[model samples]
Target chain A: MPREITAFSNPLVKRVQALREKRHRREEGLFLAEGLRILTEARETGRVPRFLFFAAASAAHPLVRALVHAVEAAGGEAVETTPAILSKLSGKDNPQAVVGVFDQFETRLDQLDRGAASIFLVAERLRDPGNLGTILRTGDAVGAGGLILVGDCVDPFSVEAVRASMGALFTVPIVRTGWEEFLAWLRGGPGQLVGLSLQTEHDYRAVAYAAPTFLLTGNEAQGLPDDYEAACDLLVKLPMLGKADSLNAAVATAVMAYEVLARHR
Target chain B: MPREITAFSNPLVKRVQALREKRHRREEGLFLAEGLRILTEARETGRVPRFLFFAAASAAHPLVRALVHAVEAAGGEAVETTPAILSKLSGKDNPQAVVGVFDQFETRLDQLDRGAASIFLVAERLRDPGNLGTILRTGDAVGAGGLILVGDCVDPFSVEAVRASMGALFTVPIVRTGWEEFLAWLRGGPGQLVGLSLQTEHDYRAVAYAAPTFLLTGNEAQGLPDDYEAACDLLVKLPMLGKADSLNAAVATAVMAYEVLARHR
Candidate 1:
């Protein structure tokens, strides 16, 4: 039987709600993942949430019951809550039926196996959480090794990014490090650095991409710094045949990822 | 000389601010496009704003001055305003220095010149304004003819969509119509409708795309309805090598657009 918590003032509710902020998430060493589908994805990936909050309305749902079992089996708590509390935890007007608080993954560059996949996505100073999440989803679709965040990028674990990733965050490995540190790691392995740049004459499709290719994208507003572009093994440009000079950062990454995937296949 | 207005309660200020809402935009037949770069892109595309609002600080900027001149030349008013008013109009705490209120394009399927471009994008029931905007940007990047909305979709003139479009909203022609109407229009012309669907065994890259290819994508969640998929001349699916079942609507469209572009080239 799950604990019934009807009060919004419940301590556990406050703790989970506090995870909405980055500082609180960091301090708590956990993050929130909302929706039954996302939570199910997490469970399938061998990640059991520390706390599972479900509205009484969805407690009978087979997926919800399965998730409750998984949480209980993992020695985690399954709390039966109200929709008001669910909405409060999710910070949405209409919250999903379920919300899960899972321990944050402490991913590092050293843990990544570069030879495991052909393509790796590297973002430099990617500020938008939505873009970061979208890139993660694209990374998953292309069977990339992982997403490496170089320079000051948005927190991959942010709720906005986590939501945008469509559960790709649970499946894809993410590495956060500075540019020099990331470059050193790449240099230690067999990888080709391909920067998507406007300055390059080579078309993205024209390039012969090597295995273990790292597709690097720059900040949304500022393209890669001049030095960053210079360091790339190959610099390629997507054709901008219309008045708009650039594609959205995440869209460009997806297009490049698919191209790289096609070439390798 | 540009007229000066500092009061947020000013009638013109309220009118422009109201454009942030869809109902008000439809009522006025005008929409807001913020930022100097976007406004410049609009001007370059031969679409001048009916009213240009600029901060006092940016009034002397070369691009802003050029915009002012263009607005005056086009018999439009350039109002010098406060940053607070700019923020209020844009609904951003730190709004861009410039904002433009422009007449929304009245695009129709009949107005499209199918022979003008080799690629066209069609989206059905796309509810997200950001995804809609990103699709426009991708369409522009691939040199597609335009984006045609099938069925009930988010307003293309929404400010969020315009911002996400990165000024591609001005360059790309947008048509709003229902599915039956769009199919009839396409059948009346020389075109191939290729839809992105998971049900297809065909790979997106494996297909030979004809000139005037119409790439159709479904809603963010529901995807292409069964009947809609049946209507496509060809159905192609992007490979999902990971656990995530699908890509973000806009990202998937971009990947598909580029693949079609590559084949035609």
Candidate 2:
């Protein structure tokens, strides 16, 4: 039987709750993964969490039992907690059955086997966590190399972004680098820099995204900085037919990613 | 000078806030529109809001003044309120410069000129307000005739849905109906119904969407019901290359909508 830790005031409970903040997540090099599916994926990916907590309501669930056993076998702590504790950690009235506390797993652009992969989505200074997350999901759908976050993009580990990713964050390798470094790498890197912007002449579909392609997107508000356009081997735009000034950043990225990768698939 | 309704407790303000709820919106046949941009689009589309409220911070903004004049000229009320009041109405601490209260504008599928539209998206029992809103925005981006909500879908007029639409609610016509009525209308209608599901053997892109094309999608969780698949003139599925069980409903719709419409545009 897993040990019971029912108190909502438990110090461990507080620590899990604190992981919701970027600062705490950074300081601890840890983040929380909610729901059985995400935790299951985490386990299957060999990224088993250090801590596993489950609500009393889910104590008897077969999958919960299996997950708890999996955690314990992997030298992780699996503790049964009160629903109140789980709800507090999740910020939801009706929380999921299980949660996992995992170490932040990331790789740098320089660390990757660059030549092995061709397609990539480069996002610059994306502010919205949801958009970034959805883009991560889209990236996975197209089997892109990885997502390279340039400049000051929102933390992919942020709760909103992770939740929005719908488990793709676990699959997608996120590379964080500064503008100058990323730009320099792209220039020397083995791929085309296809910048998407409203100021471009070519229709997004009209462009040939022949693999070994790096599809670049920018911030939600101001879009790609003016000089950044110079770095692009090609620039393309999604048509704005109606009164809408822009497509949601995630939607635009998904459309572009699919156009680039889907046909070939 | 526009009237200064300084009191947050005012009955008018109370009613406007209540419009956030589906029951209240249904009862009053009214809904709220936030931000200067959406209101401006509403005005340009000739769908003038009945009530306009501006934060005093925007008193000097030229566009705000023009919008206020436009509202009042159309026999609508335009009032100035404090930032605190605007915040209360918007549920955002830093609310936009202006908000508008508009009458519900909707129609039935039968009322639409079916022959006029080549591309259409019919969503069945979509539960997410944000997904519904994004689909509406995508529908407008492709200039689809309208969105046909089959069965009990989320209210597109809800505050969250409208907010997510990013002003497309003004430009896109929304039609709500039950399954039977929608099916009957589709049978008599000119467009071909293309159902999207995981069960289908056909790849979504393989089939040419001969217009008038009705791209039908379903709920986030369960997807389109089995019987519904029988109704589709053609059934296709987006490639599921990764571990994700499904793509976000809105993303799927956008991918399909753009494929069917963008090439034509």
Candidate 3:
């Protein structure tokens, strides 16, 4: 039996709660993974968890047991904690029964391409975590090349982002790069650059996506900056007939991703 | 001169803030509309605002003045409120400087079919306000017949819902009905029922979307309930090759809406 830690005042519990903040997560070189789905995805991605905590009562689920056994076999630590203790460590008002503390992995853009024509999502200064997470999930679903976070934006690995992703964080490769560096890399790189904007004269449906593409999208309120707009080989807009100036960032990205998929298929 | 109320304890200010909760909104028969874009859209839709509140600093914008003048012309009232009061009434910690209060209106589904094939959205128990609001905007944009809300879902006229709708609430017609009643109506009505689900056997691209159609979508967690599944005449699913089981409710709905537009065009 792995030792059970019941006290809320435990040092480990305090540390886990602190990891909810970006500063603390960076300092500790770790991030939190919630729910059975995220943990299973992380394990499958070969990202080992440093510690696994589960509610003693929830340890009976076959999948949970298998996950725990797998963690133990890999020389990682597993501990059973009471539901109360698990909630305290999670710092969430409604915490799931199982949580894992995993080491953070940095993803490089080159790692996302798998030899063929790849589709990469390049988000420029998107501030909403839910939007970014939904985009990431959509990217994962479409088997996109990877994600490049450009400009100052929300941290894609933040708690809200991770939760909204529905376990896509483990499956999609993501790289955060400055605007100058990213544009320079794209100009010299192996993909055709596609930009999404409301001011674009050409309809997205009209664009022919024949080559490996780098799709660039902007924030909901303010769109891409002028310099980045100038860098695109093509700027396309989703047809808008309603009162809204444009679709939400995530929806727009999905529409574009689906279009790319349709062309490829 | 519209009086400027500053105190957070002001009765009107407190009442406006309480509008954030459904019970309070019902008790007061009022909902909050923020941002200039939303207010402008509301006016364009012919819904007059009962009260228009704005920051003293922004009172100089030509569009802002036009909004104030339009409200007075329509036999309504306009007021200049302190930034602090605007913040309090806006519900958000940082509210848009301008906010408006309008009486909620109800529309019946039968009135929507006037010499044309109707195209509308049927939302079943959608809990997320953002999803519901986005769907309303999309529906209005596509010139849908009307929106029919079913099950015990979030009220479509809430503050968050209004914000998300981007002022489409003023233009779109909405009706609410019980689950069994809605399903029965779909069976008896003249329109064809189309549903978006991940579990469906066929891809969305495989379905033919004709007008006089009612698109039924469900809550984020579960797809449309089992009882209502058979009610739809056609079922469509977006292709998913990635790890995540689904797309965001609103995103998928938008995709489906666009597909309908494409088929009609």
Candidate 4:
């Protein structure tokens, strides 16, 4: 049954809004992604939106209408409401015309390595949701095997991460893992491990980046830990010139990923 | 004398909040930059704050007090407000402990030339403020001669840009110029011109960045303009192997900037 949720006080709306908080998202195993582009990409990937909301006034736009129709066609609920109500649900002062609450993807690390040479991303303690999402998009662009979320990193499925990913979230495979297990896996790996660290004296360009390399990065404020430094066969530092001392984690990861791609090509 | 702004409803507060809007920032030729780090960096460079605001309660942090004291010592009026009021006036949802307003610097094109050979960044219609700010920091790090803002671009002093730049705004000389003049300047060339484009068939490493070069770039969404391609003495492309078309503008710019620095050293 397609439910029409109108009130901002509605339970479904509450649940959707709750997904914005990290703890709530962790507890509920759900995340909300907004905007038409993300919704379209989600639909194309056979993702069934659990709940979809749109501004009734903007229901006339072809893109909006199409998104509503797609949601409906997928047997998901499509509800129309005032922009004011939508804005309230969306923590953002200016809400996108459309939003969707989608089920959290359950991906296993073991399942990701099935029948393929894997080139994965391991992010440790990344605090910024936007950086995580940007990395997801860049990973998708690079056709990475999957992403391994490690340490105290922000939830990859959070609203901010999803929005920043530009719909790449739906396409990219992500596996959240404990740091200890991640370290063990890297140590046990036949695959190459490339650790990105600002402290490393070695230049990034010096690394070969051959084989199925697991490109690892850490938090923006802090780079990878010393214990995990031994896990990598090579520790590479992005060439930097400023007093800021380092590039943003997402930017560094993207540059290294591109380098890997460049070498392989 | 510098003005001490205390009340949240003060016209100065309203103007500072309006800095979040691009239109307001451009129309007024002013922008707000927060945090002690940025304020201190600006002050160190002889930039006199037009106004300064700080938290009234919670004197636990020594750095906060030192920053406020520094501002007041420099003949700048420092107004203390409640944490709530400070948060409201800071523009960001979670405000930094301190906020300040400074006069918008008007940099002339001719001011870029300082003595002998020097590298400069020339950006055409760079839309993303975050990217522009990152580029500015990178330029400062490499000791670039200056920056030339070509074509229609975002104001470099916007709040987002300022935050991303990490106080590089006060140090870097910026010259905003038109396309025709930019082309003439590059072509007439006090030095060689190095252009970055995704479509360029030549590898970036192949280019000799020996001379005082104008490193030219375009927007994140689009590469350099087709007409300006001929004006560049050298066109170089970052090597890529991913499904993603190219690196983010800031990352790409940083890579090229560092590469030039490496070659120069």
lDDT: the better of candidates 2 and 3: 2
Model 4: lDDT equals 0.75
Q: Candidate 1 lDDT (Cα, whole model)?
A: 0.93
Candidate 1 lDDT tens digits, A1-265: 7899999889999989999999999898999999988899989999999999999999999999999999999999999999999999998999999999999995799999988999999999999999999999999889989999998888888999999999999999999899999999899979999999999799998879999999999999998999999899999999989987889999999999999998999
Q: Calculate DockQ per candidate and list them.
A: 0.88, 0.64, 0.60, 0.35
Candidate 4 C-alpha error for residue B261, in Å: 4.0
Q: Please, what are the lDDT tens digits per residue for candidate 2 over residues B1-265?
A: 5899889889988989999899999999999889988888888889888999998889889889999898889899998998888888888878988988999989877687777778888999999898888888888888888899999999898988998899999888889998888888888857789988999789876777778888899998889998898888999887766777568888988888888886455
Model 3 per-residue lDDT tens digits across residues B48-138: 6788989888899887898899989987778888877887777667768689988878776556562353578889889988888888878
Query: Distance (Å) between predicted and true CA of B102, model 4?
Result: 1.8
The reply for model 1, stretches above 4 Å from the true place, is: none
Off by over 4 Å in 3: A1-8, A72-79, A82-93, A114-117, B71-77, B114-118, B187-189
Predictions: Cα RMSD each = 1.3, 1.7, 2.5, 4.2
lDDT of 3 by residue, A6-107 (tens): 888888888888888999988988888789877887778886678889989988998688778888888888889988877776767777878888888767
Q: Give one digit per residue, the lDDT tens place, for model 2 in A1-265.
A: 5788977778898899999999999999999888988777766767877899998888888878888888888888998988888888888898889888888988887875556555788999999888888888887787778899999999999888887888889887889998899877776657788888998789987767766788889898788998888788899998777778678878888888878776455
The deviation in Å at residue B210 for candidate 2 is 1.4
Give model 1's TM-score versus the native structure.
Answer: 0.97
TM-score of each: 0.97, 0.96, 0.92, 0.82
Q: What is the lDDT of residue A114 in candidate 4?
A: 25
Across all candidates, what is each one's fraction of true contacts kept?
Answer: 0.94, 0.49, 0.54, 0.29
